[model samples]
Target chain A: MIHVVRKLFWDFEKEEQWLNEMSAKGMALTHYSWCKYVFTETPKNEYTYRIELLDNVPTHPESIAYIRFLEENGVECVSSYVRWIFLRKKSSEGAFDIYTDLESKIKHFKRINTLWNSVMWLEFIVGLANILIGVTNYFNSSSSISLVNVILGGLLILLGLVFLRAGAPIRKKIRKLQQENLIRE
Target chain B: MPESSERGALTEAVFYILLSLYTAMHGYAIMQNVKDLSHGRVDLGAGTLYGAINTLLEKNWIRAVEGEEGSRRKEYEITELGKTVIQGELIRLGELIANGKRIAGGESK
Candidate 1:
């Protein structure tokens, strides 16, 4: 049976609402003391498996908690796609199945990166426009444009550049996640 | 209870999934709806779409309607809560458009 856990990055209240709703719909859920949602598909033999779904990137504490949990339990935790799963010593077939799932996750992350790149292009254009607005206002002899506007525009340009810069890190994280799956295989 | 503006912070992927399910629709159908709505500008990858759908279901903004049991192509509908959220978004967008129109008019003759 499949298991699901969630480490939310977005609004905690919204996340709680989501967990409650999902639980109401017959999902087996165990709300941990921290912001971890542990769910299992069906009770099997001594061997059990679990998965986690997180909307936003988890905090360092949450990450450490998750890793530590797996390490202490001796369960092999693999993160692929957006969900990370814990696997126990099961049949060879189960191992093969897990690998397939990880591979599929890698494919999904690639698609996610592609979409992010598109957003980055849009941010870059918006940033460039802001910079131009600032530069044009500064160069203009007319005093219609306030110094504050120029400064705001410059800040906006900076923000856009930061977002544009953020795309690479996002890409790197996805690649790193994918690599984790590969290293296991 | 009245929804909070903070609650409107659904992820882009999740919001798109909810938007797609404004009508009773299945996974593939909702995916197609998003593609069409975005004029193909937004393509919801299967994994992303599935993940969003699962979260949406968990949020109660979207609920599953009757469909083939054990089938992945389960149909879903926007709840009253979901509709309220959508209305709020529409109003917000309307305000933005009106402001833009006023600004553009002021800039012109």
Candidate 2:
């Protein structure tokens, strides 16, 4: 079964939960395209999944090397898209989770926060630009279709606001990790 | 002096990594060494090991060596600087153990 989810800035926890839910339903993710995840039927909860943000997957030599290493260590490489790799290993009592210690967990959260922040920055700038351009055209146009510009401007501004609002929760999680880590050190 | 100051304290991962890489060892080998040395108490996940390797490389505490291409067989060895850092870590650890022992039992005269 293939499910399409359009989440522009999907944070780590949400993505992990969705994947785990799908896995629990006996659908193993075999591939991903943009926002679509393609799954194949398997035994319910056959494997536990992990999603990692790494650059240059299935193409770059280093990424290939890393994947090969994991496969050798009993992890299966199910799919990859953009900077994300979806991995799963047979469900067991042994550690299937990628992060085992506090330091690594902290680093993983920091990486996730950095990636999302960069994407949100780009989205905000584009949204602002679209609204400005649309509003300018709306006021300057003498044509009957000038109302179209107003609608488009409003939509762009709303979309930008949505993105900005979505980013706050993830940033709060990252900040909490940062502060907690400092206290531990 | 600057390297020592910049490196600060070694995390267990970094400490065990340097210890394991006395000979050129790949990722799995290093993980195995750490787990074995710590009597199976310390285990390094693939992700954790990968992140630690990158950090060590960036700081020049470790350097990649020749390995068969396309294998997790990407081997690394500790640099001279890495050895010095390990030595410093051992001294610090010794001091810590000594202080703890004094509290646990009686102080050595």
- For lDDT, the strongest prediction is 2
- Chain B TM-score, one value per candidate, order as shown: 0.75, 0.85
Per-residue lDDT for B5-97 in model 1, tens only? 543334445557778777788765775687678787555544445555556667677898987677544578989887777777778768878
Measured by TM-score, the strongest candidate is 2
- Residues A36-89 of candidate 2 have per-residue lDDT tens digits of 777888889887888887756567898887788788677888888776888888
Task: Tell me the TM-score of each prediction against the true structure.
Answer: 0.37, 0.79
Worst 10 residues of 1 chain A by lDDT: A91-100
Q: What overall lDDT, based on C-alpha atoms, would model 2 receive against the true structure?
A: 0.77
DockQ (0 to 1) for model 2: 0.54
* True contacts reproduced, candidate 1: 0.00
Which digits, one per residue and each the tens of the lDDT, describe model 1 over residues A111-179? Answer: 545555666566556656665765777787556664656566566556556555645654675677777
Docking class of 2: medium
After TM-score superposition, the amount by which residue B95's alpha carbon in candidate 1 deviates from its true location, in angstroms, is 1.1
Candidate 1: residue pairs that collide: A5-A51
